[model samples]
Target: MIDTATAPGSGGAPPAAPTRAGRRPATTSGPLRREYIWLALLLVGTGAAYLWNLTASGWANSFYAAAVQSGAKSWKAFFFGSSDWANAITVDKTPASLWPMELSARLFGFGSWTMLLPQVLLGVASVALLWAVVRRHFGANAGLLAGLALAVTPVAALMFRYNNPDALLVFLMIAAVWTMLRALDDGRWRWLVLCGLLVGFGFLAKQLQAGLVLPALALTYLFAGPPKLGKRIAQLFAAGAAMVAGAGWWVLVAQLWPASDRPYFGGSTNNSIIELTLGYNGLDRLGLGSGSGKPGGGGAPGGDPGGGVTAGVDLAAGGDMPQMHGGFHPFGGQAGITRLFNETVGGQIAWLIPAALILLVAAIILRGRAPRTDGKRAALLLLGGWGLVTGLVFSFMGGIFHEYYTVALAPALAGTIGAAGAVVWAERERRWVRAVLVLSVALTALTAFVLLSRTPDFVPWLRWLIVGVAVLAAAGLVLRGGRRLTIATLLAAVFVGLAAPTAYAVETLRQPHTGGIVKAGPATDSGFPGFPGGNRDAQSDPESGAAAPGGDAPGGATDAGGDADRERAGGGGPMGDEKPGDEVLALLEQDGSAYTWVAATISSNNAASYQLAADYPVMAIGGFGGGDPAPTLAQFQRDVTEGKIHYFIAGENHGPGGSSTSEGSKITAWVKDHYTATEVDGVTLYDLTATPKAG
Candidate 1:
């Protein structure tokens, strides 16, 4: 689709060509036309790979579940309801992660379409940006290849459809890149300002993660270009100021929420000056300070929830938990940042190393010392460095390990392939080499595809094909001098290109239900969705009916502001759940006057709505007529005694048996004696709000 519409020219940098922005159609024959054809095929392939995963993918369910849990309805529920509506009042520590969806929620309907649709579109935008960056900085063919490579990478494919912050992160990064490149192309300072604004928007989208790609681009520009030091520095400063202006407003507004509403978890502090600038971002990755994680944990989120010890001793309780700045924290030992980088790069780069090496060979052999065109080296340095740094830094961390972490490296890999492809195509002497390279590239990409398929154990023929591609890639790497080097690089491209198909064949042929009960997919049997917006923190809390971080079975006002006096009243004494406001679910389950649930948490209205779908089935007024959790306490108690609530479950990990704390009273004892357990959407069932069953 993009191919027919896009025309080249109207840009700057080395190897300058005539302005083609509005120029007549410049016809090319034989080789050039063939290259264009190849590019079009690759882009189509990329689009297919990314868009295909949208259906079978399981990544977006948790957010949907959380939205439901939060009592959010219509469109406003899904998008604005991060994790869940229960999280609305509670501070979430998933990096500075919700801004893009939050904005989307505000702009579009926050419900299903708002949360799910934007990601798909943004992902496509990222692909488009990648193409532009590669095409303008490098060449049209290179741009197409690079964009395709990114679009087809397994991680990129999954993430683009997954509805996570990472997809938006990619888009913001690409947007920033496109803006900056445009600025450079037209020598427009306004574009630089636009670049800065987008970069800052990137930060707002996901905080620290967005900065990785954008800053790297700037630094690369500063170091790799013509070295116009003064102008570059001034331009960068201006860009930075623009970015601050675009993104800084959010920080100010976030501050207005209670410091507790935006707790400085993972070391994000609300201290003076700097904290406001970076208080809620990926503070974990940046090393510890301002009440976040320390390097000992590899800059991962500190598993320990010590409420900042600076407050000295917990004068009130005097309990012996790790204390930081007078706050109480929890027990934790997580995968450190160092380990994160290794796994991300280690898992994916091995597939890429051979390709990168082969591409490099092509670069050196055909294009190295020869009369080079404009800005090629500078572009490679900038594009390659940013992709590598972003991927590597994230890989070294041990704490989190998701397959999609490799998206950051997409641009560079694409650049490398595009760079190599150009060299092989530019020279006529490398004809055979180019043929072999095409074959190998096709095989490697094919292999990757086979591996990622839902089913597996591919046909024997694929194994042979993989071996063939590998051999070609190796041969390409071997050639570095003149004709031989060009041949080797061409062989390499052919080798990598076919990897995905082989992988696909293998995955598709695997045994049915090979992995057992299907882990990461739909959970009609268990309402505990996969995403992390649970009322309780799944990391710390046990799944066995006892509540912790997100455990709140009753609907009561939860003060996220570390107000230890938090009451779990209705009949149970206050030993509330793990984190503050952690008992959102526990409170919601208790039967109330007129059966109204003033759901005060950040989860969606779905919890109430879905409950209506299941148990109440039909109701004149839904059981969850939203009210303040704190105010509804007494009525909730009366409703429970009147047999309003038969049971309740709350927390991040809760399904049948959720986590809980010791209650000072025996409200539970009465429940145990009178109520019978049942099931609703795989969640723990109780007769709450129902008349006690006859004995």
Candidate 2:
């Protein structure tokens, strides 16, 4: 392969360097023009894929959607992560990721489109930004491939189209990557500062998850940056400081403020943002503590000896993934070495893992230990290290790992695949490069077939067709081929790598997902658990009264009578079953109150639905799980006596004999015993205003 920098010329000299002002010397503009066209297509295609039928799910996770809506209403709620503008308590995670959604809702008047539009735009922008970053170092083709690979990855499509923090997390991380690369190229301190700011802002999006790329990025710069060793260290230190300023300002402010002045941090035991960061969102995720780890049944960390709240057990964790039946855990079920490649998770994000691995290995061998300063070596380190390290973390992290969390792995995977493609394409004349490309496509196709086989209910023919095309594309590369045939072979390889995932993504779009965690795909049948789109007839389970895991009703609630009702109420809405029902709203309106809270409910989702529906503040009594003791029994009594709270919606709890037993059980029991139960819309409501004072 000819190096453009050293191509034959009168002196066989390297190309002239760019001026100090950073303008490049003029060259033939054809490649640049072609790149622009490819970029345009990539953006347009990504937008179309993400935006198509986007609102079909209608506020993907009511949990976050409610938070976004609340944020739009109150600046305090926006910053504190409250799901309601009551500003009583924060959501489990921080509010950094919700900022854009809040702004969108505020500007667009709060609807499904407003909730999700930012995610769509962010996803598209990330693709464009990734292209720019890759093209700067590896030329146009590699950039185009990287952008396309990221844009089409099924999980990427699913996450970007949904109202999840991951969309913004990914975008900010990409921006950080792009800026970091720029800093390396320009050897400028300002770029490093900007990189830090981006990463810090990313931290706001997802706490520690956003920082996973930091070590690799910082180390890469220290080794390969153009500055002297002393200067690089100093600059990296400055960048680290900038990162802390950007990401930690909120934590600092939240901590310094009097507890009475701000909402309680939802996920933390003592309402401390720092604890939330270091524990639930930090160390516990690494399986070192009690924070929510991967999908399995891991124990929560015990409390601090000083009487801080201890982490609780999460049953939903490894028992059986929600909504999945037939042992096909689309989201990982257990934390282990092979989690990512297993049948449960592979199809969603691992469509090209085999191909990327093969290409990475081949490229590493072909590059033959190039010097640190070599562009190829740096590119390999940046992309390959990011992919491998992240994949391993996601595979082994022992806490609350969700299927969508794997979207973090998408960009790195795409980058490595693109970098490998570029190296192989550059060496197309070599038999070994061609052979590696063939091996990559074959592995990708075979792996994709295996993943698709795990869900035979989805169209199986698509897998066979993808495999056949991939095989043919591999053959085309080995056969005597013209330039057009070579291009065809490349296209075939791209198609095979993308086709199966694309089909799965299409099915995901066709279906609807709700709840705190969701996956992309149609229900296999009416019996499929957690699937809101299952056939109505197949969903009924007479014994449990609740539909099975995958068999959730379209409204997101189960019809099961007792425990299921509690789950539905506790889980919050998009349950489709929840309706403000003119009756419920009218009843509340008729009974005016001096209290800021119009009513109280167990779960944040329940309160969120009522608040959004009624445009009133309803207390989410026990936080998200109905397990957090947000407001104590004593507090509720004081609020009642002082006229700070009115109605209390009773009967949502997890206890023996379907009785009330959760964090706020004392409150629930107190309300039940004092205020007479009035059934409205099949929910037991209590008129707190009617209760007699305790002597």
Candidate 3:
């Protein structure tokens, strides 16, 4: 939303009337009366999209779901994002995103509602916030359209309903944008400070990913904000300082805390939170660091045990096999410019990207030679820059990015479409603007058609129908039925733009995207192309007796971080078969006392399943990737001797960074060599209590 409301002595243009019938009502109260109705509709629609069948996925991404449960059980776990309430180690990513989920669990007790409800509410709030922000500067109609577009975006619906950090990240990023726009509206430094604070919280939500919009916000203020340069710079500095304080304090506290009192930083080789930030969460994600494809780089809590190196269990070891099919390319391709639009990712987030780009260029050109202070021009630049910067970063960054990461692009696309469409619609009476509308609708429909083609069998009829509607709508835009025809065509165009994503969203909701990077399309049994892991086939992990029914397994099926594996501990419903079955549970319960850890395993999902099944701490010894030095051989031996650990479950040896020589692997080897193995419920178990005590 763009406005020319000026502060005292600030040089700005007069506010343009809102586009067409979208004009502000005669009185402020009058506008609110009608606006509230649309806002309510937007909120309700978004809520339904996000909350419908919300628990079908059960504890979606049981990896993080376990963390949410842990955080609910203990304050220390809540702060550290510990997968088990025992606080042995932390999840790789920051815990800010999980705080709310944990709070919900604390209030409601652990269940699907605690796991998925926060995301649903956040999705609704995001829609409302988008409407308010767009309306403040654009108009009621434009704001409503923006909210609708965002609400229907396939990725938006998929992510807002899912329990990943991306949902909160998206919400915070949008909040930051709204705050910055408000700051620009009145040239208020306080608003700017608030924007910075929101962004800093965004950092806490997703680390460096949050800074993707800083460039756009900074540039907008520097080039287009009110009045003098010195004051502006000073105000920006204040904002920056506030941002540093908001984001840095947590890192500082994490670093300065006594190591003995805190869990080891999960992804950091050196056990430093700052190191984890700079390495795995920062440079590695950009493909600038060597750890790009390593465990924890994508900021997933329980990383792929082998770092997406290979899937399927190694029968000999009873865990993920470290067969070096390739150099840890989980999604299976080199990072490049075309990554987001490829087969694996295109259907998820790229469907509307081309339309957004076309609309942006058209908006800019339609405002040809407008004065620098023109509100429309300012709006175009602000939105264009925001979309371009975030989109480019995602496009070019060489990291272990998942398809679901496209959720970040949702707001940019929605904002661009809403604001640019308003500008174009406001000028639609112009022949050129009408032509632009026709072209925009055609491109949008065409792009959506191509994206839909990727999964031909999914609502196959809609493909031709959308193209036909788009063509007729364009013809109507050009025909002679006057404003009524034009309005119908515009509505048709909006319909065509939203239809594909709406269907995809419905499909997304209908299917249980329980694990791995969720790509929008009809749910398929095929695993990700070039995925080096197990085929998306429902099979039992021979060691765990954990059967994945129809490829939607419980604990191990997901990739971790974004789209995760569907494998749960139990076989059905929210909790799934998280328990270790009756036999294993009985054996473990026989000597449950005097042991700190219920079971030890290399897979985070494995441990998560056990933790959820038993509601007791199961140590994911080596962390998500089975690579982090959460427990070395010496530490394990010492713990066993001290009776801190009881059972050691054998599983995958491969860690994210390398081969089976990791701390967790060594401990497993030592345990295997010394202790007698017991096969309980398909899991190879080592009873530490059965070993003789060495004097």
Candidate 4:
């Protein structure tokens, strides 16, 4: 269907006419000059968008924020990603993602701005790297378009601005792809090794999620690499070794360290990093066990944790509301091929998927007859494979899935769309190529319409406008015209594809997103119910019982003060969104320096709020989800008897699957049984050293 005679080579552009000296002309002339200008604009625009309101979330996801604070104060905590400087328990994730933020906080004094600035920088760098990777094979225009797509992707906007490990994980994945591509170019062992090294570091960033790209990387190189079969196999082996060395050293050190001397491995049932990696962060994530037993617990997005208000429930017609697991659903919907297009997920990163896949198939078929070393086909295979593999896993994986995890797919989608668009455009004179391009634009427009319709009240007219423009652009493309008219039609097509996602991205920037689970765009009818159309302030809804923005209460608690009894009765929830009230901070800070733990609480998020507000080491009893057996009853009682732990803050002792038998629940029961409860600014606390009273 494609005319190979007119198709551009791997360089995308025709080779420049040879000069007298037989060298390429200076880059300042023509297309090369334009490329530089556009590249600069892309980077500048991406940086501004990402940094627009960097500190508005104010320590977004306080669970990790608390870890960053602790890491700043204690090198041991920094290395271990401990929730407290006293080395009580590490955060459930590996520490690589926190290192940059910790170092920033250590240098500038921990605060919202310092803690989140590094994440913004990582976001900007990822965009720039993506541009470079795409530009190498495609022309400047395609590279710029790909970069723009990623920058405006809603989830990319969310995670890049938020302090989540996903940001670093994404950056490493893109860099690895770039390095692997370089290896394929020349069969260079060093390039392959470098790619392996990046992936290894990626493992440290988020464990096995980093390995999803490996199959694509290895398969592409094995099939398309310039080296002979034996040599390519040997080179891949070296790269694998590099990957092990890069990621293995940390695993080795962590496993070898004395468990007592280090913070307990927070996610593991046993104090073993190996178990944490292989179990909690690994197998459990694949639906083999309770999905990670993560902090928020899994349910539909914005669904009531108690199942009183199901995500899709209509409170106006209320009868018996369905009860489901509390917290956001790991995947947006049931695990299936269409999961990415569901109401909860489509708006985040699925905007361009339909277009990307269409164009990917077109590009691969167009280049099917090219030699094995063809760079264009290799790139298509690499990016398309990455997107397909990662997308399927996110769609079907039964473990702790979140809508935001879709950020991993953004780079691949963006790159594939750009590369494929270029390949097909080069042969646009072929009627079939034009048909494929028009089909892609039409499908993308339809996708936007469906996604926008889910949140009908917000930007109601934009969806129709996108469809209108796409229809016109498709017509214009079908009917050959003058060069200016063709360019105009192409611009309209691009607008149709990008408009809704950009609007969602901007909305994501406008909102103040906090807590362990967050969704992009304005609240939709399917996921978040309490907030009316376009009202994202869940804290303002008294019925929601969510922590107010910047308030130091746990995520699922009532207001401080008059509701103390109800709050104590209800127990604490996931990540707290607000700062600790001043009175509570003062209470925790009083003579806090003398104790190893200024206070202790059931969940990491609750303890994170108090520790961050008081600037002290507050122990998270059983780590995130309050389920891990970190400090046993004996260990906690010993600490309390020795005056190491000063107070026990009343909070949720049980998590999604936890019970009274959990170590955290036992600690809470023991403390409540022994000490007099004191109400500080509506927070219940038991003084560990005030002397036990007969209950």
Candidate 5:
């Protein structure tokens, strides 16, 4: 057990004298110097990796980027996370994740660097916090290793450098765990309350996904908290109250504000935040209900098809939806036990998962007889439960899954490996423990081989190198001799376990990713068969301006280029990557201040492109997938009659799979009936202010 092996002075050394606080005195200068040096190196390395070439993504997910832009322009938009300064409709989720970027953009002036820099800082802080948490129980070496593991996770590296909610969500989750563990150590009410507050803020970042850690937190405290039964129950109630307060204030404001004055609660059919939480962001995410409130209206893959306009296409001919770049499977490759290991997802966060699971079991069995309040066992329970619960939900959940969502698993896996590895190493003198260590390394190496084989052409030799090193390390562990030999063998094992993921992380950093859905590592056959390259842009017909069916386009176009060129060269369609042409931008900017909105579009993705370029509010008829009824046709007609909206840009109106006679389709039909179309460079626009022609 860890208690017997790692006890102070248990390894034939004199016990350190206790200070007035009943804690051991500080270690000698030599050991202290090395620990601080390693800590410094870990933090510096993480910051450098996350910050390298941060601007290459250039408004990464322009959907969020456009919202950040709106928030920077108007305080109302900032508070509501509206898609435009005019506050026609808010983005699909809560505004907490956008708050930091909005504040930064307001202070530094909005640009790619200003928008993304906050995310990078958050990623680095997560690494440092993970190290501190592990070091509090395990040794310094274990802490450094955990930090390194998290930093090199491919998905972690990708999301940290991009402007997405996952970065803030992950940071808040880790901080909550840290505080929960501190409470376990002392049975303090304040720490538990702080932990609740952190989780509540996490809810504001990504909704229900933040609550995945709640079970582990509550169970850990109940079993391992220093307080007696009655006090522990009382404290949990207090923590629950704090959590409600932390997350409820915003919900109250959004619900209590006069419906006519504030932005509509986006992603909700009834314009209610409560519905948005329990329906769209909650049950719909779990595949329990249609996210858009209509029957079968969720954004599931290959669902019902709806009609919409595309560049160079007529309103009657339902245009082809934009395809995912590289033919990557968007649902994380079907719901089941092996989902995480699928080609589309395995390369991101699955590299260390096998080892983490093995070590978690070993740590649990070794600590089985420890006392009820043992901190080491408590930490393992917290981390292991977190990884298991979150991983299973990710694997089997049938709705709206992305490969990058695996980033949530990074911190828990890293902490488990660090804590368990320390325990197994302390008992290395036992032959069975050494054998378990060898088996864990072999399994990890085998996993690396399979994942590496999927991307054979990318670092082809690395997989074989890992297998060879793993074998050598196993033999060295079985027949150890000197201390130097043991150290060398341990180094080989580390290389075998970390080399593959680290390579993938480095590759992720090299490429510039821009899209609503992104993956880590080089392109491989892991994507759907027949989609084998990294290019994400759909090919468009030069003369007709319509995207070619099943054609590929250039990927990673910068915002500095001509807007029309960027649209043609990138995956700009319903995917939200499209930018306005020079002619359209000029047209929209002319006398734009006279109207509340320069233009309106059916989907947020389509509207985000023009809104970002025009620097004006362009009402998204429906939120996100064009399903929620933010503005009914009557509302839109009222705006047009009052000369509030200038133009109506014709663009895609359906969600991913497609919608079924949703409000977006209705608005599009009415717009076409009432106005004449004007083509500018390839985009279709209708001037809403002009008198309607005879039907």
Candidate 6:
């Protein structure tokens, strides 16, 4: 967050002086020990707040779900942190954005849960970046305020705890921008190289989202600067190299892989690697999903379809969204080129989540507007744009829209929100306004804790008291200043107050088996992410609980143009109540070799029966006709003569992602005679797997 006045124009124009500083230097000197101290306090406070969410509740986000599914398919990939997540297991075309965790896993073998740590780790990094950016642009107080704001933001809180690419994306993007600014300012070639490398790697973490944030920020600065031409070009080129290093490896590999190996959807054609790669990650300015908007997440500019129905209706009738003209997107041009920002960044999130963001944004606009010359202002523009761009592009994903998608834009937004908190300090005169500032930060912190306190073990009353202390601590900051005694007391009070709630959260996570989520990769193909402390009791609640067996997906069933019945899904898992320890229930939650049967099977694995029947919703592949694979050649002939096995599945197992693996010629014969293929995912369904037997 460099102030423009101190930062030389990328276009070579000098920035305007601040109204408050009559003789502010073009370049400001620096802070002493206090700088690190306040930032450290900020870090400790934020860490305490988010640590509570470590095991608060729910499942791993879709990105991690895709990763964990991939992990299960190939242990080698899982162990080596493989990049082979090309739609073999999960539904998404490519989870290329999961490079960092894969790389970490390949290097470390702590299991899937380690992946979740990356989000928190990156969140910590984002706070650090905020501190650094704010320190450079504003002062320690402003930096501290920025850190405090980010710590409590609902979105920031979610991204920090949830397993997704956004948190990591935010960290890397900020790191890249911060480094790039440094590189350009001092003409340090090494920093530029670091910038390039960071950009490239961040690009890998969340596709082009991170890579573009830096350039976008730079170019935005250029908007403020008249044209310097040559210098701007050189700075961009140096930064470009950083992006290439981190993300370029994937491009080369995607090119070399055979076309058949890469059955990507979206706008990617298996032409050459470059075309596939670009369309996969770069194009679509507004596309959603890993490969989709990396084609069309952009919607019509200023198009606010009030709620999803209005958006869907507009897409259907307004000629505004893609219409099915000849079964294709009719609005397939530039309007379609960039996905709507309103949808991606502004649209998604819990209704309250958006409400909170609106509140923060409004607060900044009305009460907390920082000096225009402040570098924090520049940082805000950059981070704000980053969140807006990713949020807008990813929200329109036709298929999966997990909570982590919000992570992509979170870093920029978090730090900016924190800066907004500091804007409260800008009001030097009004005592009441400053009191409001203290109250706002405290309220924000309290709200975040309440929303995050969904875990069963945590006592709601205790959490409220912890929040009360944090509010008091925040109030202390205004009345005190740089006095060694007040600052130290204030710092300790603020941190401990925040830590109490957070500490309770972490302790609650220690108990395993509580209903929770894991990042298991695509079904059967691969899988896993996260630690194993859970308290999941996947049983029917006596009090208006879901079905005794697992119910349908909470976010709704993901039907990527396939046969899936939500009614059948609610009953997936054990037919009888889930026992104290149920592996099938666990497996059911993950993406794995899932096959559904309406009737029964020869296998005596009771858990399997309940698991398959209750957790997964696809129709059965056996016993519908004469028998799966047709009972025997003679039986098959009799059944065929009798017209049995109306539907069935055959062919090789194709490893994980292949067609149905159920075998035996008699099995195949019986299946065909008695059953008909119903609908399939990687599994085959039969209209009949068993004969009527004249019953």
> How far off is residue 343 in model 4, in Å?
0.7
Going through the candidates in order, what is the number of backbone clashes in each? 163, 29, 31, 11, 2, 119
lDDT of each: 0.41, 0.67, 0.67, 0.75, 0.74, 0.39
User: Model 5, 1-695: lDDT tens per residue?
Assistant: 43422533122222242232324566667766777788889889888987886665656677788889999999999988888889989887889999999999999998778988889889999998998777667767777788999999999999998777889999999999999878887788899899999999898898888998888998889889888989998898888888888888888998899989988777676888788788757775665654324322433211111111123422112233322222223447766789899888899999988889988888888888888987778989998899999999988775556788899999999988888887777777788888889999999999999999988889999999999999999998899878778778878988988999999999888766665656788744332211111133121111112111112123333233334443442222233544556688899899999999999886676677677777778887776656667687788889999999999877554433225466666777788898998877656788998999787
Count steric clashes of candidate 1: 163
Deviation in angstroms for 628 in model 4? 0.7
Number of the top-ranking candidate, with TM-score as the measure: 4
Model 3 alpha-carbon drift over 4 Å, by segment: 1-31, 292-301, 304-334, 367-376, 525-579, 589-594, 654-658, 693-695
For residue 461, what is the lDDT in candidate 1? Answer: 56
Poorest 10 consecutive residues by lDDT, candidate 2: 301-310
Shift in Å, residue 554, candidate 3: 9.3
For every candidate structure, what is the RMSD over all alpha carbons to the true structure, in angstroms?
Answer: 11.7, 6.2, 6.3, 5.3, 5.7, 12.9
lDDT of 6 by residue, 472-529 (tens): 6565656655456344534544453234324433332321111112111011111111
Question: Candidate 3 deviates by what RMSD?
Answer: 6.3
Task: Tell me the spans in candidate 1 whose CA falls farther than 4 Å from its real position.
Answer: 1-49, 64-87, 90-115, 224-227, 257-281, 286-349, 357-374, 398-401, 420-461, 470-492, 501-695
- Where does model 6 exceed 4 Å of error? 1-34, 48-59, 62-66, 69-100, 103-112, 187-193, 211-215, 221-228, 241-245, 259-377, 380-404, 417-567, 570-695
TM-score ranking of the models: 4, 5, 3, 2, 1, 6
Angstrom error of the Cα, residue 392, model 6: value is 6.7
Model 4 regions lying over 4 Å from their true place? 1-30, 290-331, 525-575, 655-657
C-alpha TM-score for every candidate: 0.59, 0.86, 0.87, 0.89, 0.88, 0.52
lDDT of 6 at 637: 48
With candidate 1 superimposed using the best TM-score fit, by how many Å does residue 19's alpha carbon deviate from the native? 6.5
Deviation from truth (RMSD, Å), model 2: 6.2
Rate residue 270 of model 3 by lDDT.
78
lDDT of 5: 0.74
Better of 1 and 3 by TM-score: 3
lDDT of 3 by residue, 1-695 (tens): 22313211111222345443234435455545766876887798778767876765666666777788889998988987887887878878788989989999889888766678999998898888877666666666777778888888777878887777888888888888887776665577887899888888888887888888788888878776664788878888988998888788888888888887877777778788777778778776666766433433222334333333344433223243333222444552435677667766676777667777877887788666765445556666766787888777777665565767888888878888887777666666568767877888888888888878888888999989999999989898788376567567777888888899889888877655554444555654433431212223112221212223223234343312111221221111112123345576666566665567887776576677667766678787767656677776887788788888778776555333334556766776688678887766555678887855353
Better by TM-score, candidate 4 or 2: 4
